[model samples]
Target: MAEKVTAYRFDRIDETLSQLNREDCAIIAGGTDVMVLHKSRRGVPPKFSKPIVFIDHLSELKQVYQTDKDLHIGACCTYTELLEHPLIPTPIKSAIKTIAAPAIRNRGTVGGNICNASPAGDMLPLLYVYNAKVLLRSVNGDRFVAISDFIQGPRRIQRLHNEIVTEIILPSVLEEGTHVIFEKVGNRNADAIAKVSFAGFMRINKERIEDIRFAFGAVGPTMIRSREIEKKLVGKTLPLADAEIDTIVAEFDKIIRPIDDQRSTAVYRKTVALNLLRYFLSLKQ
Candidate 1:
């Protein structure tokens, strides 16, 4: 008879990460992606070997804080937690709460969503639009990486195996007329991954746009912040003629590149993204 592999849980991040660094153990969070990968024998080790270190109990990673200057969300804050956090701005809370179902949202950590490095990850586009930062730590020390630069490609990242993501930092977005919006185009809007998703930030000054930030996900190799499109919208006021809106729409089309995948066709994704852009721009409520 073969020996059965047992799972382990870590109560402290520093202690567990240090041990895992020495032993090269497998890390598990929600076990959403890990279990599937193991079952399929795709990339992860089988259940019979490598010790599994679960970090779900790290209380330090489950907090959300807001100061006059910034918002700090601990790495293990689950989607359900974020949805309920009083400091998470309304639009962001609304967007993330709708991801998958209640059960998955309850278990999926925001850090896992990021460290997993999936382009289609629901929380990523929102992170990009908010100018979030990822805090990483290892036995060596701590470092911060911009969310925009953290994810390198589909299922790839710059995160070293020895490093653990400790926190996510978001600057305060509390302001009058600070319009933030998120859009996702999916087949059924039920357990559907984003065929294409976008998030935008706008601050209105008088009758004009003061600042703008735009981002898109599930359409490229990684979630992207489109500074070029954002630049075009900044200082541009609404109630403009049809021609100006048309020009802006054309510019948006140039920034996003959608590809065909199991969930949707390339053409459909592109068209839907453009339509959503128009819809978001036209909204006042």
Candidate 2:
């Protein structure tokens, strides 16, 4: 029979890092994902190691605030907390509602989702649209990493062994005349992983476009911000008399590289991505 597991909790990152660097430790946040892994025996549980660090109790990283210029979301905040926060961006709030079941949302955290770096992670596309920055801390020091750079590949990140994400920072909100949209094609209407997700926001200047952001998820190794697509849309009115909507759709098709998977086929994801882009453009009307 297996021996009972042991666990440790800390109120700080430095103290936890010191413990982790010396012994095998499983990082536990919301435990939504980790619990499943543990039940499945996928990894060594905390009890199996000499010491395990529980970071969910670090109150220093539990702050959720917004300044006139930016929104600061603590890494320890749960999805339900984000959904209930009054200052959260409307687009983000809406997206969080569709993330998972109520039970999962109640226990799942934004930091864990981001750190997991899953391509189908529900909030990642929203983070990309806002150009979110991740704050990471370790025993050595602190540093900030952009979400685009923090995620390296499928279920991977650039996080160091001792580093823990402290918070996510979003730039100040945009003014009026800026439209935002997030659309995803999932298997079911509720609690479904995105087959292909697209998120975009743009500032329209009279008949022209000033700034635009586009992000696609579950289509590549990571949720990607399409600078190429944004560059093409900037300074130009979409669905213009000169540029047809079909042309913009075609451009998006070329920008994303999707693969055939169990949930969806490459051809279908590409087609859905184009349709989602068109739907976003229509919202500007």
Candidate 3:
């Protein structure tokens, strides 16, 4: 017979961290993904045999606030909550709005999305463009890590077993005149996983690119961001000549090596990723 699962819920962060330190357990906050995996195991052996510790009710992990420099979003804040919140940046709002459907959005937490670490996750590319940082906590203490460093690969992260992500920190506001864009290609408009996605932020002053960043999703083991490529574009003038665009496109071709997956072909994803960048450039032209 399979071992029965047990659940523990706590209202205090300290108590939760103490329990995690004492025993092995699986952390669940917004059972959106966890419950699906559990229910799908019909006859198959369960992947998780440990007890579950529920943190969805922890008030400490559900806040959305701002400081002088950054906005802090608690890990348990759901996609629905982000949509309703006034402080969410335009690019992030645009990206999160494309996630699943209304019901899943209501139940899915930002931390759950980050911890799940799906390469196709809609929020990741936005987080990358914003240079967000994740705050993690444990019985020992707390630490902050950049979004890129926090998520090492698909379904893998640097978070320790006893640590829980408490919040994400992002710039309180983008600079004036900055333009942000998010583009996604999927099988369906709603409730569909991304075949390829792109998120970009750029600021132009006097017809010259003052700052810029780009992130691509569902095209690799992890979301792709290239500071080297971004550097080449920053300080360059807008309306890039065809030759310059071709050079940049060729550089991107070398960076992304997608593999054929159930949702899309590698060729299609690669082509779309490049085209998305081209489209963003066109917007400025």
Query: Cα miss at 274, model 3 (Å)?
Result: 0.8
Backbone clashes counted, model 3? 0
Higher-scoring candidate on TM-score, 1 or 3 = 3
TM-score ranking, best first: 3, 1, 2
The alpha-carbon root-mean-square deviation between model 2 and the true structure, to one decimal in Å, is 2.8
* Best of the two (1, 2) by TM-score: 1
Over 1-285, each residue of candidate 2 has an lDDT whose tens digit, in order, gives 456766778766678878766666667889776666456354644232444568887887678888887899999898888888888878788787777888888888889889888888888888988889998887778899999999999878888777888899998676567777788789887778899998888888786888888788998889867687678778876545425666767777777789999999988988888778777776644
lDDT tens string, model 1, 1-285? 344675668667888878768766667777776676567445545563577778867888888887776888988888888888887778888898668788888888888888888878888888898899999888989899999888889878778778878899987666577888888777766567888888878788776987777777887889866687678777877755577667877987887788887998878877887787776677663
**After superposition, candidate 1 runs with Cα above 4 Å error:** 1-7, 41-50
Task: Quote each prediction's TM-score.
Answer: 0.90, 0.89, 0.94
Q: Would you list the clashing residue pairs of candidate 3?
A: none
lDDT of 3 by residue, 1-285 (tens): 566768799879899999999887889999887776666356754456788999989999999998986999999999999999988776678777788889999989999989989999888888898889999999889999999999999889998888999999996465577888898899998889899999988888878998888999999999999999989988889787788778888899999999898889999999999999888876763
Query: Worst ten-residue run, lDDT, model 2?
Result: 42-51
**Where does candidate 3 have its weakest 10-residue lDDT segment?**
39-48
Off by over 4 Å in 2: 4-6, 21-24, 41-51, 238-244
